[model samples]
Target: MRFERCRMLFGDEDFEKIQSSKILILGIGGVGSYALDCLYRSGVTDITILDFDIYDESNRNRQIGSDAVGESKVDTLAYLYPGIKTINQRMDMAWVADFDFDPYDIVIDAADTTKVKIEVAKKCYKKLIMALGSAKRYDASKIEVASIWKTHGDALARKIRNELKKAKFDRNFLVVFSPEEDKCKEKGSCVAVTGAVGLTVCSEAIKRILK
Candidate 1:
């Protein structure tokens, strides 16, 4: 009954597809945490969440898990959302090789670290989605979902493209990025921009699985 409305929108068969699809998400910060929220409420029953960081007082402004400061992100999420088959681990690129890609329908990279983002981009086997440059911007309308090759203006996007090119990665991949340049270095990011990036990433994952 919890998902009855979802069943109405997707039909029973496609709703089953949504429930059965597996998604792996890296990072539990401003962007990834919001993405997790969207996917879980949208009827994704199988999810693998990985994050090496703990909630911080500073994260309260954007992250959903910000209240559980000093707790492991995975543990907090597992306790908060029960009954879903969630495989959560404190992981980073150092242990990325151990990840089994075969089971996942999609992999999302919302890590704030540029190195980690590039690593995920380079090694991901499943349909990959990454978010970039949601920081220092107040405008959520500038956020765009496009192929990584066509994405421009975001500083992180440019860096990722440079790294991918050197590695000879030619595959067209989806990226949630903003072309708007944030000029003020002292200006901080907010939930509005980062949450939009997260929701966009989740939407892309759902579309990929359904289509």
Candidate 2:
């Protein structure tokens, strides 16, 4: 049916894996929103999106649902994708502490906050795929998925590396990052880059699960 195109690439048995997989997406901004888009269309039937933030005018340039101001991101995605679960809560390391990650097969960290990314990397029991450094740059081709330690050039990646080191968690994690430097001093984001990173994160999650 709707997943015929996906089933063509991976046979019926493999395509079933995508449907059975449950993914936890931690943000619903520029990157996370696109991740949701790709995962849902790619046949991932089970997903729980978490984000307490509402759509804002400023996010119109890159984030999905930004057109609907004041709309809850969690609810927006659930409504758009239908049948998916959602958590309307502000997430940080503190929130994840009490959270049970048992039902998920993969956790995607698309949170813009550095601490939240660190928390996901440190505490998440399921395999994690995170987005890093998708801001400012317009070239979507620059983004790549690599081990966190092998990532460079992006300021966010450097910060995450340092924090993970301090926490003494040296385990290698896959991250979608861009080596292209930020175009300006101010924090900025664009849909081209963020969307690309989001797609890459979903692709990595699917590959890991199938393997």
Candidate 3:
């Protein structure tokens, strides 16, 4: 079955295949939450979210729900998207390493910790991963990944990617959530910026899949 909303873009074959491909999202913050909505509309029916954070009042700044106060954020996501599968636990490589899971076709990283990003990359090196996948996609337009991307889709990323290719550094999606000048931790932000990043993440995901 097709979600009418995405009918304008995803047609028969792409939608069908995408619906079957399992997606594992690693964060549930503002960016991840927004990206989830995009994923749902895009017809990715099987989604697994892993986050260990509980709702807080401060999250009202950009998180999915303020009413979810004290509730497990992942739990809230599962409820909003009924068919979604969720694992509410802090992601550690050990959790993934010891588990028996079908090799996920894609991994979306939106977790808050840099450690989580590195760990997830190590844990799921075999599949095609997406930028900093999912939530991390938000804020990436200006968020630099170690001077690689001065702005979103900058040339340095291309340079590094080419070097990695030459060195055969296992091909994987390395998306960065760029921090905008105004939203810099040096600055501050609202949901608008967070949403921008989430949509961008989904946009990149679609583009990659189309390519």
Q: Where is the poorest 10-residue window by lDDT in model 3? A: 128-137
- Clashes (N, CA, C under 3 Å) per candidate: 0, 0, 10
- Tens digits of lDDT, candidate 2, 46-148: 9899999999888899987788888888888787889889999999778988888777899999987898778878877348888887878989988877889
Task: Give the winner by TM-score.
Answer: 2
Per-residue alpha-carbon lDDT of candidate 3 for residues 5-86, written as tens digits (9 for 90 to 100): 5665677777677677777777778777877888887888888887888898878878775478999998887888889988
The TM-scores of all predictions, comma-separated, are 0.92, 0.96, 0.74
lDDT of each: 0.82, 0.86, 0.63
Note each model's CA RMSD in angstroms.
Answer: 1.8, 1.2, 5.2
lDDT: which is higher, 2 or 3? 2
Q: Write the per-residue lDDT of candidate 1 for residues 1-211, one digit (tens) a residue.
A: 8999989988998889989998888887889889998999989998878776778788889888789988877788878767544545555677666766667889988877787677777677347998888888878899899988898787788888888889887778789999887857874778999999999999888888889
Whole-model lDDT, candidate 1? 0.82
* lDDT preference between candidates 1 and 3, better one: 1
Sorting all predicted structures by TM-score, with the top scorer first, yields 2, 1, 3
lDDT of 1 at 66: 82
Q: Lowest summed-lDDT stretch of 10 residues in model 2?
A: 117-126
Candidate 3 backbone collisions, by pair: 131-175, 132-175, 138-197, 139-178, 140-177, 140-178, 141-152, 143-178, 143-179, 184-187
